[model samples]
Target: MKSDSTVLPDVFRICFEHYNTAKNLPTGKIKNPNEILREFDFEIKKNPADAAELFKDMQLYLKLTPNTLTPNFQNQLFSGLNQYALAGDWLTSVTNTTMATFEVSPMGTLVEKKLIEHMNRLVGWENGDGTMATGGSNANMISLLVARNKMFPEIKKEGQLNKRLIIFVSEDAHYSFEKAANILGIGLDQVKKIKTNPNGEMEPSHLEEMARVSLSEGEYPFFVAATAGTTVLGSFDPIDRIHEISKKFNLWLHVDGAWGGSVLLSSRHRHHLKGIENVDSMTWDTHKMIGTGLMSSFFLTKHNGILRSSHNHGGEDYIFHESEIAEWDSGPSSLQCGRRSDALKVWLTWRSLGDLGIEIQIDNLFTMAIKAKEMILEYKELELMYEPSSLNICFRYRSVSDVNTLNKKIRHRLLEEGNFFINIATRKKETFFRLIIVHPDLNETHLYKLFSDIIRLGNKIKEETEFCMVKT
Candidate 1:
């Protein structure tokens, strides 16, 4: 726990400098293993290295890593860390505490509870229960666990019964639902994929029919997951229509809003999740939309006390003391015993922005998404794969032949050039770049630059191919 006084200051100086200059740096440069080895001395030695030498290594590592802070970096669901969120993260690290008990994490526990309460109310739950999860995937699993335990309470002690338990989700929903099924011992076969419309929203009629078939086959249909924002197409399922069917079948309704849940803050875009409050549970990640840093995910439930009852193990007598505040412990509700204080960054971001500031941030991103679409339509070379429902805008460069191949090549070349970092996804056998406009500073200029880069690289590839064919 001891170090040279100058070492700490030197490390902070490098980090602060990088944060200040990241926007000006390259988004990322894809490097092969040999090239990376040449660039960085990544070997571990038995002896401690000089502090100055280690600091230099840190700088090189940061330089080589993708600069996600830049507006051009849109490869993933999240971008741009809020300054206050970073400050809160530093504070949490310095404190070095677990969130298992209120006695150990008094402020941490209160912050998590306050955030959960605020988010629950927004989801239309007046008196609901919730907990911070490790990530969106973990939150989705928690929802499934609670739903299963609630329907078959005896399974807690007796284990799963002979009856096959079934869960339903849209064909385009996040893959975490299926993963959760496997983890919960609900066989992959029991995770039914409901049909989605061309826009990627779940078809309520198809879900109802599938539920009926499950019942006819004597299967236990207990859960239905609707997506607020699917990964590839950024589409929102019709929650109100889906709710009607869930009620008819007596299924536990869960909304997976990990990507687009922040739209709840937007007065204009909240309608996409109009009936979210009616759902039994929800998964929302503030980090994805609000720049609250990583792992700011919450699993909220309208059913109070369900999570604690479903997960409580009645741990050792030493840990679970019979104190008045023992009920405030979060360990029972969470999947992990020693959970990190994930809520501090979220609270700091929320407090800095307030509700209205978050609304403006989301509203602006939606506006930019529409603008990106408009620009794509103006050019014949660029094809808009699907109308944007959120910030994800999928499109590809047009080629008379090998359109998919051409788009893939363009993406690869873009990464190699290290000018921008975006991602591509395939839907219905077509591949296109899934441009994310989540970064707050992202604007029309960055979008144009992206399109220009793709077109430029795509045309170059086509010319080279034509020349090869002519020579042959």
Candidate 2:
């Protein structure tokens, strides 16, 4: 057995070693459940394990897990870790306090309040209110709940009655909206999907037409969500145009900017979210683009105190005490009672980078996106699927036949090889590679190598298929 003082230092040393060598590690190694179970000792016993045994287990865990910190990782929207944010996360764990009450977590409560204030300013809101959510999905759900409660105040206490409530979102909006609809007691079928343009942006005219039809059919259209940076093509819905329809139909307008909200940091690219201030509420995920740790999501609204009005109930007699700073308590506004302190990491990251540094990082990513598009164009075999509106670049290799199948195979091979980690998306029944350029270390050299490998793998697969057919 080792003392706590000695154990802490030894564990930290192991963590440091793993962190320093993460870049050299393979992005991931494919393994099935059976394979992993066979390889690792993941059993519990009545007896306590030795400290040395636990240390070895920790090392094994790090070795087997995918290294998202490396440049080779581009499989998801988020990649790479901010050192300051990491430090903040460590500190948050060391403190181990709940954000339920201001008294217990005074600094944390203030940090969240200040971060929301800064984000509100970016969105052009003067007297706005917000709360850190579990994730973007949670934030989006909160938006729906608040909108529903505001429009039909009776529903909160009296329950959803005979009224057939409806909500509208672009066809390309994240599926989380539908999930939110389900969770918020709004039936899934009641969620309407407005048609989008060829570029994947919401068609404002179509939105108006649908609202009119819904009104004529005696359905109450209460919410219209405009997507800022859709999931697949990364398209920004015309917020200004959509706002007109929302106002005309008396609908609560919410922008699901979970994927692209960070663009507000960049002066040159902030135009993507034009007219954002007019929206009633928004969902922003700092973890996606800002590289903060996971779950740094905010559900912000221009309407002051709406969050508390919607979510606060039955907590005053207990956790929420009567004090001057009781108004600053975050539990009353949040959906969860025992909320983890998620604000510190985002605050630390933002402070370390400052607004200018963040803006430069965003601008540089856009530049990298353009470079990726150009590089794809230069390749004779590669075909661009859609002109990228943001950081997500969709393209695929050309095959004489079964192009979609070939592209899927190439992606699988890339994953199996563990040389490059990327993703593929299917739209309109056509599958293609969806290269997310998010990691700061991702550059021209990495792009060139990825393309070369993709082309090589595509050609190899095609040749193998032809040979098999000839043999048959």
Candidate 3:
């Protein structure tokens, strides 16, 4: 039997081998719940498992999981992995420290602070403040909370009471905003969806009209969230135009840049967020675009001390003590008590790539997006649902009748085949494939293969359906 120390090293080696070979393998194998339950032994027994059994379990776990690093993986908003970021994540797990206090996590605290400063500068906020969130959703929720507290300070102590607070967001905005409103005591009905134009950009005129209506109806209009990149269409709301309306109504403006914030690094693409600096707050998820490890999200604001004012409460006597370094403590400004050291991975990734390297990466992705659009147009069978705006490319296979059902069947067959991993989305009652191009390894070859497979599968399914109908 191998010693415990030796076993861990061996396991690490196995994991490294798996990681290196994943790109060459199929993206994933689709397994239903019953198939998985029968294939793997998941029972936690009365006694501790032996080393050999544990090792086998680890191997099985790796084998069963989907390979997100492969170019075929265009499923979610994020794909691939940054090697430097992975190293930082490993170090964080080994150290195992919370970011609640500077005393316990000194290096972590400074790294997080410096990273926030650099990100804020990119957003054109010279002296802004921010903190790492669990994910983009959490950061967005925090934005709502901070905006609410700052606008209605009395609500913190006195509670919402009879106050009917209203929030305005584009109809194409992330669903997280609706969840945040519910979590923050703002009723779902109070979330007014502003009308969007044909291109999916928010109509500024409709926003102002709604704000006026809210005020007249005795509802307190507070926050307006503009999406930097909408989920399905990847549309960026006209931030400059929206800001004018926010100012007129004294509404807190927040840009949800979770999927598109990294565009700020690209000089050419930064125009998407033209009036970002003027916004009251913003949510950025580096993990989505930069390919950092999961959960590298930041909630940034121009107002430096608002986070402390909004979230700080209790913990003074026990964890927070009076000291020179007390100001460095992140607990006061955070919604969590035991936050993980998420900034180290992001900081390390930035340092390894530098601003110029990341800029080039973003620029290259935009170019690739254009290539994808061109390819979609080249094929007669494949139809482009919307023009390429950012990384997301929404398209579907053309069919004579029952186009929606045929496309859905094509996607389902593609997943079962396990050669590719992409996603399907519906916009305006029409279904299409939402291909997210974030992985560095993705190229023209992968895109060609994906479309070829989709077309081939679509033709086969259609022919089979026709044959069955003729036989009947």
Candidate topping lDDT: 3
lDDT of 3 by residue, 1-472 (tens): 4467667897879868876887677788778889889989999889888888899998998878888878788999998888888888988988899999999999999999999999999999999999989889989999999999999999989999998999999999999999999999998999999999887899999999999999999999999999999998899999999999999999999999999999999999999999999999899999888988797999999999999999999999899999999999999999999988989999999999999989998888888899999999999999999877788999999998999999999999998999999999998999999999888778899999999999999999999999999999
Task: Report the C-alpha lDDT of model 2 over 229-283, residue by residue, as the tens digit.
Answer: 8889999999998988888999999999998999999989999999999999999
Worst 10 residues of 1 by lDDT: 314-323
What are the Cα lDDT values of the candidates? Answer: 0.91, 0.90, 0.91
Off by over 4 Å in 2: 1-4
Quote the positional error of residue 76 for candidate 1 in Å: 0.7
| Candidate 2 whole-model C-alpha lDDT, 0 to 1 | 0.90
After the best TM-score superposition of candidate 2, give how far the Cα of residue 187 lies from its true spot, in angstroms.
Answer: 0.8
Pairs with backbone N, CA or C atoms under 3 Å apart (clashes), candidate 1: none
Clashes of 3: 0
**Estimated TM-score per prediction?**
0.98, 0.98, 0.98
Q: In candidate 1, how many Å is residue 306 off?
A: 1.3
lDDT digits (tens) for residues 376-446 of candidate 1: 99988899989888888998898889888988888899999999999999999999999998999888888
